[model samples]
Target: MGLFTRLDRASVLYNGMADRLGVGETQRIDQPAGAAAYRSALLRCSACAEAEACAGWQMEHARADAAPGYCRNRGALAALRVE
Candidate 1:
């Protein structure tokens, strides 16, 4: 994919996964530390080898207690879920 396309896809996947785990909006992670984690999560998702699997997992789970094991942003997202 081109740069914009890749970023868009990653943003969608990142947000979708967050929603599944009740993490609300990515933009809402505005505490200095949270903002950093949010940025890292997007970057990680953009380069993730498991993007395809993540998309499938999001499709299968409308809402979930946690992120899939393969998700690179699992811990960051879980933190967001708690806050």
Candidate 2:
């Protein structure tokens, strides 16, 4: 499988958890600016106490935003689908 394909699968997992947990849209994180910021965020996020739950909400919000979304917390999760 490809890199994006892997991330997409991971994103789906988190999305499912978010649904089961009843997390809301207001919980989605903010977007990061560039590659470095995104990477830093990803590392920091990995250590978060709420990483699993937060990741779930992020995945859903990303899907709504037409993700492969970037953020200072979760990094990019998917590429925009092409026609």
Candidate 3:
């Protein structure tokens, strides 16, 4: 994960804290390229060839009006294809 990326326990905890504090940006993965890199590293073991598709799906799914600046995939970056 990137320095700004949160996952598993950190993600859950951060989300909870952010909600309570009304500080959504604190837990957001606003840098899409960075977030995509982190996610690629994290899920590298998976044999799925649909990483880019999955990334796009996540971006669309996480869309919200509250924090338009906050994106789950940072800059809406596409995932790298596994060789």
Candidate 4:
């Protein structure tokens, strides 16, 4: 409802989505560009309108090869996967 609350929810969704997709920050965040992308994803998520849908999607997908179509960072997060 509040700014911090929304951001917190976004963070949860973002991390949850990444977890399901088998992506982790430790392998990429060491680079400056990757770090920037990480922050960008969080901010983009914080501003997203599909946060509720994303949470529900994560609940259904414990392990996935890709993010849901509606995910704002779908391509970006996909690129993070090692292969």
The lDDT, on a scale of 0 to 1, for candidate 2 is 0.40
- Collision pairs in model 2: 32-71, 68-78
Instruction: Judge candidate 2 at residue 49 and give its lDDT.
Output: 53
**For this target, which candidate reaches the highest TM-score against the unseen true structure?**
4
TM-score of 3: 0.25
How much is 32 displaced in model 2, in angstroms?
Answer: 11
Q: Write the per-residue lDDT of candidate 3 for residues 1-83, one digit (tens) a residue.
A: 44344335334432433343343442335535646644553343133344445445435544322322333322322222111
Candidate order, lDDT descending: 4, 1, 2, 3
Cα-based lDDT at residue 40, candidate 4: 85
Q: How do all models score by TM-score?
A: 0.85, 0.34, 0.25, 0.87
lDDT of 2 by residue, 19-78 (tens): 333433233233335445434434544434554555556555533433222332323332
Alpha carbon lDDT of each predicted model: 0.81, 0.40, 0.37, 0.83
- lDDT value for model 3: 0.37
Which sequence of candidate numbers ranks them by TM-score, best first? 4, 1, 2, 3
Model 2 ranges off by over 4 Å: 30-83
